[model samples]
Target: MNRSYEIMFIVRPDVEEADLDKLIEGLTGNIVSGGGEVKAAEKMGRRRLAYTVRKFNDGFYVLLHVLAEGGLITEIERRLRVQEQVIKFITVRMDEEEKRLAKVKALRDSKVKRSALPAVEAVAEAPAAAEPAAAV
Candidate 1:
């Protein structure tokens, strides 16, 4: 079954913008050819790393949101591992997180819609208590 994923990778800082674009295209191409869908691709630009990785202090950051099966993700990870320009990378599965967020939002919406009238009524009647006790 397909699932949501976010793959972020850091490439060497010295790489050219053109090369970076090519690399991103290649990865996204792989996903499409592998029967996965590329939902989004973002280049967050170069920035300092919290700590050194592969002896590099900063790198170009890229984020990808995709939907694919587990096997395809594994393959993509393998490709990233072998790409010399990439210094660090991580893959996170977001399906569960998305589902949880949706559930919370639905519950919140239902509660708000259900009690909206009551909340308005309470607010309208709060002036008596909100008064400063007639200046004590």
Candidate 2:
């Protein structure tokens, strides 16, 4: 079954920008060739690492959102493991998170709509009530 996933990876900071772009393209190419569809790809740029990794104090961060079969994820991870430029990488399945977020958003939207209607009705009634008080 196809599932939603988020992949975050840190590349060695010394890599050139052009090389970084090529690396990202190659990784995404692997996903596409494996029958996965990439939803979003973000390059978060160079950032300081929480701790040293492979003696590097900083790294380039990239995040990718994808939908793919379980097997494809394994393949992608395997490729990352063998890549020399990738200092660290992680993948998270987002199906449950997505469902929960959707539920929360829907509930919030409904509450907002309900709250808005009463405010407008109350404002409309206020002017009418003031007119009667003035006549009295």
Candidate 3:
């Protein structure tokens, strides 16, 4: 049976872009060998992490949407765990019901115009100050 997954991983901030591409190439090759088809792949770039991890404040993020056999996800995750460059990783299963809903959501999101977003001031009231600042 075919199944879908959303896999996300954070690589160490020190990795060069060329090495990162090589790593991605190796991983995708493994997935394809294991009978998986990559749907959407994205590099979300480096961003500040909520908290420090291994003394690093940022990580390079990558996300892959794939369709593959159910058992392949476990194999892929195991490989990731053994890789030193990967700081964190996760693979989430997407069932048929969720897939359908995701398709609908994607379609809806694509149709919305960025300029059509409502003005922030018109949407809510300003908050009052809770306490006055003390003089130095």
Candidate 4:
């Protein structure tokens, strides 16, 4: 059975971009070779850490969406643990309900629909005498 996961990892800021690329490439390769498929990945540029980690105050963040077997995920986590450059990481498994909700959210996020009523009308009905605002 295939399972979906959202993985986020933080790496030390001092690490070079090439090294970071190698780490991500290595892990993704491992996932595919171990029977998994990567869906989406986003690199959230380096930023200050909430609290110091390994005596550092900032780290680079990366997020990945992937589908894989259960056992492969365990190995992925294990590989992350042994890396000196990784400060912290998290993986969230999507259950049936969560997966359904994610699909709904994706659809909603991509839409471009305007409401029939203006903001004020939607919030509260005005007196019958009030005139509609002039169009821009």
Candidate 5:
């Protein structure tokens, strides 16, 4: 079965733009060749990292949205680990998160919309009702 995944990787900061493009193309090609669908491939550009990785302070960020089987994903990760330019990488399954969000949305939609008017009227009537009771 196919599942959605987000793959984010950080490449070495000193790598040239052209080389980065080629690397991304090659990886995407691998995905397609492996029978996985690339939903989105985004070069998020270079940015500073929170902490130093492989003794580098920053690197190019790449995010890929993919739909594929688990075996294909593991193979992709293995490829990334072997690649020289990739400094750090992580893959997350998005299907569970998507399902959770959808469930929350449906629950929110099904909830009863409570109005404040009735409660306000009850509070307002309480004082008048108490005054009459005291008089009686």
Candidate 6:
């Protein structure tokens, strides 16, 4: 089954911009060729790493949101592992997170709708109540 995923990877800081673009294009191409869809690809730019990786202090960060089958992820990870410029990488399945957020949103919307109903009823009743008071 296809599932949502978030991938965050750090590339070596010294890599040229052109090379970085090529790398990203290649990775995205791989996903597409593998029958996966890339929902979003974001270049977070160079950032200081909390701890040095492979003797480097800073790295280029990239984030990708994708929907793909489980096997496709393994293929993508394998490619990342083989790339010399990739300093670090991680992938997380976002299906559960998406579901949780959707549930919370629905609950919030229902609460808002419920709260509005009482206020509307009160407003409707107020005009009728004031009519009798004004007549008296």
TM for every model, in the order presented, reads 0.88, 0.84, 0.71, 0.72, 0.79, 0.88
Candidate 6: 10-residue stretch with minimal lDDT = 127-136
Candidate 4 lDDT trough over 10 residues, lowest sum: 127-136
**Clash count, predicted structure 4:** 0
lDDT digits (tens) for residues 97-131 of candidate 1: 99999998887666556455554668764455434
TM-score of decoy 3: 0.71
Steric clash count of candidate 5: 0
lDDT of 5 by residue, 10-37 (tens): 9999999999999999999999999999
- Give the residue spans of candidate 1 off by over 4 A: 119-136
List where candidate 5 sits over 4 angstroms from the true fold.
Answer: 112-136
By lDDT rank, best first, the candidates go 6, 1, 2, 5, 4, 3
Tens-digit lDDT track of model 2 for 90-124 = 99999999999999889766755655565566877
TM-score of 4: 0.72
- Residue 3 accuracy (lDDT) in model 6: 99
Candidate 4, pairs of clashing residues: none
- Cα displacement (Å) at residue 72, model 4: 0.6
Model 2, residue pairs in steric clash: none
lDDT of each: 0.90, 0.90, 0.80, 0.83, 0.89, 0.91
Writing each residue's lDDT as its tens digit, candidate 4 over 41-123 gives 78898999899888999999998898998999999999999999998999999767687999877755443122223435554
Q: What is the lDDT of residue 38 in candidate 2?
A: 94
With a 3 Å backbone cut-off (N, CA, C), the pairs that clash in candidate 3 are: none
Question: Residue 7 CA error for candidate 4 (Å)?
Answer: 0.7
Selected candidate, larger lDDT, 4 vs 6? 6
Give the alpha carbon lDDT tens digit for every residue of 5-36 in model 3: 88999999999999999988888988999989
